[model samples]
Target: MRKVGVLVSGRGSNLQAIMDRIADGYLPLEIAVVISDKSDAYALERAQKAGIKAAAIERKACASKDDFEAKINAALTDAGCELVVLAGFMRILSANFVNKWHHKIINIHPALLPSFPGLHGQGQAVAYGVKFSGCTVHFVDEGTDSGPIILQKVVPVMDDDTEDTLADRILVQEHIAMPEALKLWAEDKLVINGRKVKVLA
Candidate 1:
């Protein structure tokens, strides 16, 4: 079984999705560890409920940002995690930390990407009046949500949608998209060429 480490900062809806897929035998993944920068994160609770190992490492407790990442790196390594998944992890990992994972890390972003790459992606799309808004599951790189896209699911932006409503709809797609990305990744069906990701048969 392939082992992965998941990082989360907020509610772990995506993480729950991955766990659900794995439980159903739709994914060949074992969650080695779930780490959160916040002690009170609901993600940790989800992890514990699934009987998965959970670690909460506060950033302020570390000597520096590098030190913080170092501790996380150590945890992943100790757990024998081959891949890292960022499920709403808010921290921007250091360049060195990203380089260590290289193409082994993946993140789920709440937008089509390269459009509204930062936070509040749902709000950005709503404010921009776009007809379509969705989610992207991509490899993690040194850039902020600028990595090669692995899979994307587009959700139509409703005219009568608030941020909460749109995000709720997007979350449904996220649950589907994230599992697909993880399946492809574990099966070695994704190839990163430059900025593009190719899914092979």
Candidate 2:
């Protein structure tokens, strides 16, 4: 089984999804560690409850972004993590860090990317009045949410939907799509050709 490292900054609902999948034997991956930028992030508690290694390397405490990333990298390396998953991690990684990991890192976004790339994706969609909105799981690159798409699950935008309501709906799909994308990666079924991700059957 491949070992994965998860990075989180908030409540970690997505992290919980991955763990649930692992426990149910739906995903053939080991969660080697969970690291959070916030010491008080509940994700750490969830990891501890699962008997998984958990750490918090507060970015504010580090002298520089590089230092913060170095600590994170060391933690991942120590735990023998082969892949990195960003589960609601709020930091914008440096280009150097993204390059170091390259295609080894993946992230789940609340919006069908190449659309609402930054924060408040659901809000962006609602404000833009789009008929369809959804979630996306893709490789992490230097650019914001511009990586090759791996998997996407679409949810329709309702006329009376607010950001919170739309986000809640998309969140359900996010929980499903993130694990599916990771499963593909673990099974060696993901092929990255330039800007595209081809899934092999």
CA-lDDT, candidates in order: 0.95, 0.95
lDDT tens per residue, model 2, 92-165: 99999989899999999889889999999999999999999999999999999999999999999999999999
Per-candidate TM-score against the hidden true structure: 0.98, 0.99
Error of 2 at 146 (Å): 0.4
**Local error of candidate 1 at 116, Å?**
0.4
Cα RMSD for candidates in order: 0.7, 0.6
- 1-201, model 1: which lDDT tens digit per residue? 999999999889899999999999999989999999999999999999999999999999999998899999999999999999999999999889999999999999899998889889999999999999999999989999999999899999999888888999999999999999999999989989999999999
Candidate 1 lDDT trough over 10 residues, lowest sum: 160-169
Task: Tell how far residue 195 is off in model 1, in angstroms.
Answer: 0.9
lDDT, residue 45, candidate 1: 99
- Supply the global lDDT for candidate 1: 0.95
Cα lDDT, model 1, residue 154? 97
